[model samples]
Target: MEALFERVFVETTVDTDQDGQYDLIAVYIKRPKLDEKVPAVFVANPYMLHCNEDWYDLYDVNTNIQAYPSQNIQREDVTFYQKDPVVCPKKEAEQIVENSPYPEPDPSAYECISDLYGHLLERGYAGVFSGGLGTRGSDGLTMTGSEEEIFAFKSVIDWLNGRARAFRDKTRTVQVLASWCTGSVAMSARSYLGTMCIGVATTGVEGLKTILPEAGISNWYEYYRHNGLTLPAMDWQGDDLDILAKYCFSRALDPNDFASIKPLFEKNQKTLQEGEDRQSGNYNRFWDERNYLQHADRIQASVFVLQGLNDWNVKPDQGIRLYEKLQELGKDRMMLLHQGQHIYTYHLEDSPTLGLIDRWLDYYLKGIDTGIQNESKIYIENNLDQKLWMQEEVWPPKSYKSYRVQGNGNQMIVDDLSQTIYDRKQKNTKAWLDELVLTQNAHSLSFDLETMKEDTRFAGRAKVSFRARIQQPTAILSAMLVEKGKQVRLTPNLDGDENHSFVFKMEEKPSDYFVITRGWMNAQNRLNNYSKEAIDPDTWYTYSFDFVSNDYTIPKGHTLSLILYGMDVDQTQLPFVVTEIEVDTASIVCDCPIE
Candidate 1:
């Protein structure tokens, strides 16, 4: 493809540091060289164009290279390194250039999205790729999913629609306008970028025709902690926001910009610390802002939500819950659930995801009669091994049966009897990250299902209600649905000593055990997920919590097990309390589609 439009750094309308002056955002634009306006597609994310590992290695480090040079001018004649005299002093930018979290990106570098945008330009669509606030060349301190972060996204679309202002240079001398945009836009991205799409879409921003958020989070609370239980600790303890800021926030910068950005860093850090109460994992207004689901009714754009059913990182619930909200609002939406883990469908061989996006964009942005609206609302890969994909008009397929299983000592039975004991002192098994405890623990209880006489799939969250008594005042519990059975295992069968990317051999063998789904809760927060209440020691209370949603099949003869245990390690350092659980086995039933 040929260079069609010059890449320009467009400053957005967000003063992230509350510095009165607006923060600068970098945008690389490409489009057909025509007088007619075109619809635009861009992936809004904090990871700048050149941050991808592949792109970093593909391009040379040229701090002075411009992303898009004038059509008539040679690229070698222009210097890309333009400093902001007001916000980005030369001394600060030089220091940041020397020592930043991420090496400053060479403006000329191209990555996957850049290539994708090139294709978009060829299709007569404009493509604009912008780095998130606080990223390289973009102004402001990064706050992963904060309101300011989301507002930055809205500002981009506003710019396209002529409602927002954007500057072309550091001094705001050259005003770069989105004159080539038709005021119709679509946002597409995976993971965090996708998250930005959701955040912006909820605002019902004008000119945003559609959004495709793959594995994007709808609730920040759900993203980090489940219900009341925080994820296990590795080195850090307390809120997940701390961990997110530690990893995703952009601290890397140009030395010329560092002096202005340093104070912003300290301010953002202080805000994060004060905003998210690390002492308690409960929800607050801070989390409420991040919870896009609450504002789902405000969404005006069509949505194509996709997520891996088995994805635990962002969790399937993130996208699934949003999909459900969109449905309730009678919004134009479609959902695709596949049998992968936090992956993009385009990465899969011969996937139709791109085609779907094209059709969706066409229908919304171009008003083309693509008939995407008539298509099935939901598509799921029913079985991974068989590669069985199924479509339905709605999620939680209506044909599924609900079977109530009661819990007996070491056995899951059809009988319903109330009250089972969960004596925490019974076992001292420690919890690990995302892994089920295969071995029996005194602090845990496990009930097993009989070998399946027929192939059965649990396609949704299993409702678990039980009465429990705690020896102490507080306790955190992890419940997991596990499958234990022999299955054909595939291992790489290699020839010679070389491991080729596309040329891999496989050997099949028998293996046992796979963790299907898991859920967590704090004992005191049994009634409200966001609030904690004191529990009297030895007083029996009926606690109800749902297991994480799943779509997994237990082949005939395989046994399914429900294991409950206390998580010793936690992000919030709450004192460990012993818990005893009693349950009516009949109250525990898996509600899902079988076929």
Candidate 2:
């Protein structure tokens, strides 16, 4: 076992902080001891290798030692962060300390990724793990999803393919190379690690044969913010790259590594600060660099994307939107959407999804005739029945019916515009449902659509449109699709800080009923995402936005309910604005494809 694995640091060509010195990538390798070259699976992550926490439960800590050969890289360039003692403020420093319970682990220690590493090795495949730019023992400042970070990753492939230079130490004292690599690399990981894989795969780097990204982010903007709205801490939230990079790289328990890398860490703070405009929460050049789908045409590798339809953190839109672009470009791709949250389906109990992934990697990485290419391009799991799976040629049901419901105060007609005034007291505090259920509350409107005569499934993004006018400069538009029947399917659980506790928890709880999908939009972001359009006091404006996408079936005889609220006190911190919505019952519509 000892002979099968080795760890080393590969120097990347990109100058992360533009200090003229190249960044180094710390990597762990495990492969067969046989004399045959093998395709490698590269796991590029910023957490495990970079963070203080040691989650990789490999061997007993007492018995494990640093068996891999390594060299001490000396730092010649110094920066402000290295010289400064208090780089982070008291509040920011406390946040990192409170969340991370584990003490810092030694970077020199060689620990294996218990299940994933060994499983691939047993299958005659080599595996590599490298901390993203500034994480772990790697050199340079960490910028999450930055061009520099992605290029650093590309450098790793360059090294494996004999296109780049690596070293044994900073002195360039000894040169080392990937002598045993076949150069056909596949990247796979979940969440942030998975995002790195997709980010680099967009470069179309040679030798990157395929990628399997699970719950990976294709666009950084969509991951942390919606169309133009910043996501609350409860759903999808993260700090700026500078803070996050420092959180991961600065807490160096290894005194030597910290001393050498501190300057680079401080240099990163300036770049990250200048790079992102966190306050605007709008799409710009900054996010464009982080969006991999924009450069999907450059990808030379096959892609297998995994997403959870119910995931609110890194929502399904991140993967599905990218999948659509790849499909349009005639790229070879496959997708699986399940009824899970932000999780790796392969790790689920007795999951057959794991076998599907194995066959995918085998066909592309090993050049095996697994017949995976002949299989359907999309696999969708039923929310109600985990055992039931449906295979399709494309996502979002190519042929489907559209249902439109218009609701007035008295009745909901199929095509009539309804006029209603929503004017709840601006200063009222209550639960989201309690406010909605109180029909007397002028701010909320609940509509009961016609019951389903037969079972119907809506597959794809839901579009809600209506003509509305608000009294204030800004207002929040929130729509909730509820399935009211004899039983409930989803159980609503509240979690997170006081500001976001109003959101329904998507996981763990069980019930017969559940909200299908909810859509939220700020009144100002209606016309242009970057600029705000003022309302003409009482004049109505037609507004439409997509709710999160979903593929769910409504049981027969169930009445579909549409609940609209002018403002959610729980989600927004600003003062409430009363909203007046005018609709010829038919003018208001909740359009969804019936699959």
Candidate 3:
């Protein structure tokens, strides 16, 4: 498709940094020549303009977990911020990208979204891209998923509809306009870029007709912390909201810009550090601002949620939760689930995931009558067998049943989990399974389910509840469901073309055990994420929480093991306290979903 015209400009947004000067957002636009204006596909990402080669700044998680008050305390939860995540920035701008994360993206990063946008151009649609504050060409601090970040993105759509202003360059004297756009916009991207799609849609932004967020986050709290634990999203530890903000602070890459904004940028980083509350790992107003699920009621756009069932980075739960909420709101919504780990669905062969997206956008953006809205609302790559796809009106399917499994052994166990279980660098999961689940640790307890009568499909979080009398004021306890078997687990397509992508490979050595799901809680925060009260020593209290969301089929003859332990070595913050808890086995029953 030959472009009729293309332009790069800057749009102004509120001074989230409180730097007196308004923040400048960098925009790149392209459109196929046509007599009539056309709808546009939009992408707002921080990585486009510039990316830090390295950003290691993180909170000190090795420090002791903070103690709760004798009585419960909940921070004033700020669901909607009155002010943008007031950031800090000083600027000298640059020039940048398009409807994709890159006009020409890294091959690894390039996928169906870019391809789809290019295809749209051939169909007479336009494409536009922009970066928010603190990106290389944009002005303002990068607060990661801050309120300001969301607004900065919304402003671009506003600009396309002529609700806001844009200048041809950094100097505001001359102006430019997206006169070629039809005001209807759709957002399509992956990962962090996908996250921006969800954030802006929550505002019910006028021009946004639809949002296709692939592997995006709905709640920053759930991303960084879970059930009151500072859980890292696979791979690295110590990476928090502050570190993420630091990584996207690309305006500093320019030496002159760095000299001007370093101090203010550091100040913004400090605010993030304090607001994130790394010590407690509890939900607060700061996280509330980045959460989109709570504001789903405000969304007026149709949403196509895409998720990798095996994705550990963003996890399978984030998109599903948003899908569920949209369902409750009775809004237009659809879900596409795959077997891949943190990957684009463009590669899935049998289903042709990207084709569905093309139809979705065509219907939403152009009002095309594709009959897509009448199709099954949920689609998933079956885990029981690779390359097989499944579709139904709802997830967990109508055949879903709960199987209860309980243990009758001793419940009293004590161990100081603050000590390291392995050399810090030794993060091999098979070894962790050996040391923490299969081979018994003095501080952990494992109970087994009867062998499966048939190959049952297990899908959804397991509900675990137990009454425990603890001797400590504060403690961390965990529960996990492991599949005990000698079976090869099919991993999602890694990097490969379509023909080779469908050929599945084993994720790990065929082993005797594989952990299916896990749940952890700060015993004090039994009521919810916000409220926490120190435990009255020796008093019995019931704790209940869902295991991390999961979808898999436990094989026939494979017994499911329910392991209760202290301090998750892989997912929680550490406290150096020698703690003990007496559990009532009768009060413990794990309810797992089955089909």
Per lDDT, the best of the predicted structures is 3
lDDT of 3 at 594: 71
Give the runs in model 1 whose Cα sits over 4 Å from its true position.
Answer: 9-11, 49-115, 232-239, 246-251, 384-386, 398-439, 489-508, 568-595
Models ranked on lDDT = 3, 2, 1
**Better structure of 1 and 2 per lDDT:** 2
RMSD of each candidate? Answer: 12.9, 13.0, 4.1
Q: Which candidate would rank higher by TM-score, 1 or 3? A: 3
How many collisions between residues are there in candidate 1? 22
**Residue 237 alpha-carbon offset, candidate 1, angstroms:** 8.6
Model 2 Cα lDDT, one tens digit per residue, 372-428: 999989888775555577778876774444445555532211110122232233333
Question: On a 0 to 100 scale, what is the lDDT of residue 542 in model 1?
Answer: 69
**TM-score of the candidate numbered 1?**
0.79
For candidate 3, lDDT tens digit of each residue in 1-595? Answer: 7675444445555685565766778776768767777899888877776667677665555545667885455456544566734433434334222222225334333222345566678877787767668877678889889777888889889988988766656665456667778899998788888999999999999989999998899999988988777887866567898887888787877888878888888898899989888777778888888888999999999999999887878978899889889988999999988877777656456765868887888899888999999999988777768667778676556343454445575477675753435543454545565777777666777788658989877776668888888888777889888888887777665646542344446666687776788888888788888767778876789999888777777888898888887776666664567788778877787878774
lDDT of each: 0.63, 0.64, 0.76
Two-way lDDT contest, 1 vs 3, winner: 3
Superposed by TM-score, candidate 2 places the C-alpha of residue 593 at a distance from the truth, in angstroms, of 2.1
